[model samples]
Target chain A: MSHEPRDNPAQHREQREPEELHTPIGWPLLVVFLGIIAWGAFYYFHDLLSATGATSEAGDRRSVVVVDPTAKADGAAVYAGNCAACHQATGMGLPGAFPPLAGSEWVLASKDIPIQILLHGMSGPITVKGSLYAGVMPAFAQLEDAEIAAVLTHVRKSWGNAAAEITADDIASGRKAFADKSTPWSEAELKDKVGAP
Target chain B: MSLSIAFLLAMTFLISVGGLALLVWALANDQFGMGQQAAETIFAPGEVGEVEDPATPSAARAVMQNARKAAHQASDSEELFERTIADQSSRMPVLFWLSSSMVWLLLGSVFGVIASIKLHLPDWLVQEAVLTFGRIRPAHLNVVAYGWASMAGVGVGLWLIPRLFKTALVGGHYAIAGGLIWNAGLIFGTAAILAGLSDGLEWLEFPWQTDIALVIGGALAAVPLILTLIKKRVGHLYVSAWYLIAALVWFPMLFVTANIPNLFVGVDQAMLNWWFAHNVLGLWMTPLGLAAAYYFIPKIIGKPIRSYGLSLIGFWALALFYSQVGLHHLIGGPVPTWAVTISIVHSVMMVIPVIAVAVNHHMTMLGSFRLMLYSPTLRFVVLGAMMYTFASVQGSMEALRSVNTITHFTHYTVAHAHMGLYGFLSFVLFGSVYFILPRLLDWEWPHAWAISLHFWLVFVGWGIYFWPLTLGGWLQGLAMLDPARSFMESVS
Candidate 1:
């Protein structure tokens, strides 16, 4: 074999394999990079830690039922002010931009489901009326528990979707569930999960 | 759409596809494993006296002294020995890619000028379907930003990165594939917009399908670059490589997240839209231009960078400050006062990175100012580096709430955008192109006049676009701002 090493003795050849090489700062930077990445991952998923709300124990209307008419009324007005922008005033939507709030299972289910959905946000492929709606719902977790409660109550009643009326207590309960967590919900992971308060 | 518009769109797609396919063919054939040890070989005597009937070495020296033209033809140049992908890649391919980019840029510029004037002369180009300012304006942007600038950046990056690292490209095929996919996205997106099917979000205006295509292309281009860097034999990572890689990561993330229906929902849309729009400038295009500045300034002067530490400062500060500062775009919007406050804070705090880069570039060229006259690379790089400072200051000034109220929806915004995109980024790209094209192609520019014409066309034309006209338009908007008068009456 013609052993004509073009320039200097290469460390690559001396090491015999590419895997033997290392970044100059070695594992520390790689570790720091990993740490940064891990922190980012934790931040992305932090919502799961603080996730809480209604506790459903089958056939219990208390969990899924609306007790206060005033709570429902307040929720409706709040929903009109906030949620109305995307879902639209008529509960329809701007077609592809925002999904309809009317008759949405995510919006109408147990108060726990909508509460969590509102707080931390939900993402991915969802089915409403047999049509798969892929949308990103931003977290309204920043809003007061009462505001979230009122908005959910409003969406449930005002829209053609009439389910359980959401009370502030229901939402407040949900807030205690994931007090320390706040990552946006990934659609695939939470697709089959229960609804929030 | 008119036949010409249709034809232009189709031609753009065809050119992008062909260019991509050519790169893929070259990569698969190991064309990228060219004479990457250029730096090592650059110092050699070359093939001057090494021909079959060798000319005397002294005779070769004398030949070199008299006229470079004769010496260039007579000397069996190092080009005679070069035959890698770098060699086979050829000048025509590079020029073909570059000229296509420039063509798109010119088209975009013409459309933009019309759009600017059409604020007052809505009847001028509003008569036609495709020629409407709404359609033509975006078509212009697609051509210049995506078609011209991005394509040219990739072309130069592909050629330069591998050469600098003295490495054979392992994933160049993926880059080619990505380039085609990206171009397809641009064409489809531009066409959809021109068809009045735009999503109507400023900068996030493209439809979903186009968005997906662009992200995929970004991944393809990024994969090869990441691979090349990993396999590189270089001892130290250059500042230029850092900027190029950072852009690759930034562009894809912005494109994917911005267009995803699930991520940017409702109220978040306004916030996310500005985030993506600014990054496309700060993260995507700025990095490409900055990389050129880092490379050309030092390379032209034949010295190490003035301070590698400043380069590091510039890179990280940009990452930290630019991302946080996007909220400034929501200045007058109802998106919360805190967000606006943070954006303005970071926008002004942007001085750190800009100054770092200025120090590095200016100090490096401290004694080399004389070379600006002799070297085209130095002139363009200095021009771009200085413009970077100017644009960043203006960007900060514009982000202030009081200033934004006067300029936000006016032509001043357009002028600020032109200053950053064209004034800063385009000039840097031009310098990089001048420096790399000759090295990549083994042949001198066949027609220097054409290249000079291209530069003058861009620089001189921008004066007309931005200087007095854009400023006057903004002042006129401010005059129309008094609360006592009707909107129409004030404007009139």
Candidate 2:
């Protein structure tokens, strides 16, 4: 044992354990932790309990609604689920691939032109806001007439664009007009038939 | 789902409150007031008795007595305790756990290498489902985090805690059993993961059945440590003991809470997943690494810490702030904005403890820069401490919305993780192993060249692994943000 201690210098060095200082300052630190928890709880419950009707900055871009209150809410929901991915929540669509619904001449032109586009999709080169976009817009003819009306109404009134609300009657008329159309409409065909705004 | 969320929140609340209450009790009882006496306890002769020598001449005996008295007045108890602790137990269980940790480290490294190769060569292992990137990646993560880092930490803790508490290990057999069971669990869990029977959660990828084995194994292994703590000869709980014990307690609670079958669903499951994942690092691995650094740095340097107060702040702040910061992983995700916001706030608050730890360590090593040259342990530990500070500050910044916007889905996050787990935690653990092995095994390292080689290889290897990923990943993120750049352009 003596030889062992002699061989290992590390073992012979004295351990210097620090004196455990008495510090009363830890209470305030604990308070900070508690405060954070309280704030988190408050925030969580506030988010959960509060209704979605609060007019947020996000909602400001899509405020126009002259339809039934239920229809407006349904339209917002429909837009969020179906159209927001490519066209974006603000309807300020992707730069090259998707065309913007916000401030689009086609959306604000007339109910028939937009309704026609919704019933029979559009394709090929098209100009939106002075940019040439060659993209395919899929048809939403499978949507209920009321749903089509609500969503179109949402797009038309949103993003500072004011237009008359498209109704179920208008969607029904557009569907009837494009009943025989199976494939997407070409830009030339859309312009020839529906006419540019 | 809501009930589980409430349960998790309640658990966090209870832990915070319980910890605070312990502090309050300690304060009110003046447990900290007898610092000098408590510091001297390790040196004081135990009730077991000491041998007396009466054969010496009067003059020689007088000189010897005076020398003994002078030595008692100084801080020589550390040396006495060291010898006592080393000689008390067989130290076989610690060796067993450490050996198991090394095995896992090698296994994990193999998995990690395979996983990394598959990243660039996706078709290399496409033939077998077991070898697919998805399975191998999770296995690598689990093995390294739970299998390597954790086992190594526990092994080190088993050896270190008793020495700190100045008590003989009470449950050596139980600890060995625990180590075996833990390894068994890891083996089965890794196999199950490879078989694609995963639970589909990050860090909790082990199915519930496998988790049971781990939970049991961990509990068994913790028995001796807890017992040692209970029968501690010292009055004051050292900072290292606080970290080690808290980690032991925190881990089982975290493991059980996060892995309960079908306890949460949808986004709530996601929330709990991140909560568990982040805390496993913050609470478990981080504490172990920090605890090692706290112990070895001072022990090797043979000095008291600069500020015990800062150490307490560091420990408590880590406990409180680290628990909630996990939700920052889900920023810009489907989870609620409020949850993400709170997580961000908590993540930023991590700076308090990081700085506390940094200042304490920095001030302790203020004039001892030359120790890094001669002491292999100091070199590794000091590097680890520096990396810890760097990794944590980077983590805080990364949690911010501005930085996360670019770095969120990039390899930058991966680089950051490696910096933490491998660079910081693993490095510290390595230092601990180097320092402890000699004492436990009663042998010096066979070759100093090997250690030097290891230090350079790992240090350089980490630099190579980390910098490219960070810079390249940042560039990739920038490219991804631009609509004009093709996805392939960013990837390639």
- The docking quality of candidate 1, as DockQ, is 0.01
Question: Which 10-residue window in model 1 chain B sums to the lowest lDDT?
Answer: B49-58
In candidate 1, what are the lDDT values of residues A146-167, reduced to their tens digit? 7887677677777467787677
* Candidate 2 wrongly placed segments (more than 4 Å): A1-10, A13-197, B1-31, B34-84, B87-90
Please state the CAPRI-style docking class of candidate 2.
incorrect
The lDDT values for all models are 0.64, 0.78
**Residues B93-172, model 2: lDDT tens digits:** 88998899999999999999999998899899889899999999999999998889999999888878777776678788
- State, as a TM-score between 0 and 1, how close model 2 is to the true structure: 0.69
